[model samples]
Target: MKLGIVRCAQTEEVCPGSKDFQALREKTGVFAKVDDAIELVGFTTCGGCPGKKAVFRAKSLVAAGADTIAFASCITKGTPIGYPCPFAKRMIAAVEGNVEEGVEVLDYTHGW
Candidate 1:
């Protein structure tokens, strides 16, 4: 199953604390993981809070073969090393409301 990762719009270079998309891909072993299981195929930012493009982008990813969508733990957990953006909740709600049907949304944070 192909998955999609939606994250904060902050650039990796600018946000040194941002979660590494490549590392996540490697750690999840999407390329080598068991067949038919969920795997990350694409990643993008939420266009920085009020940007409405996140909903469309997420929908497109799902249409393109993403079986699931996920937000990084930091964004949902409010870790000391990382702070959750207020827009994070809004984005998740938007994605949940607008994305394709049956696409699983996984919050890799505490109490998800």
Candidate 2:
């Protein structure tokens, strides 16, 4: 399964997202439970508040062949530092609305 990851821009300086990438590579959390091998297609931010940029980013990922969009645990679960994204829900909705049918939008890429 080709997947795209969306992370919190606020945590970019504090977290490099190495753990999230490692978890995804190791097939941890939901990835481990899935049957197919997960391929990372793209990684990007929600483009700050209101997440207006996320819709386009998601569409771009889908266009790049990402069949699933996974919101990194930093945005949803708040791993490591416990600072979750405030606009996660809205960002998710925008991505969901933009992506095509059958493209899975996962709330989290890994667990805390």
Whole-model lDDT per candidate: 0.62, 0.84
Which digits, one per residue and each the tens of the lDDT, describe model 2 over residues 1-112? 9999888877888888887788788888768787788889999988777577888888888999999998888888877679777888888987888789999999987775
**Candidate 1: regions farther than 4 A off:** 14-36, 78-81, 109-112
Candidate 1 RMSD to the correct structure: 4.7
lDDT of 2 at 5: 88
Q: What residue pairs are clashing in model 2?
A: none
Residue by residue across 1-112, what tens digits does model 1's lDDT show? 6777766665333554334444443444223333554456777766665647778878878877897777655456643336666677777888899877788776642222
Give the top-scoring candidate (lDDT).
2
Best by TM-score: 2
C-alpha displacement of 92 in model 1, angstroms?
A: 0.7
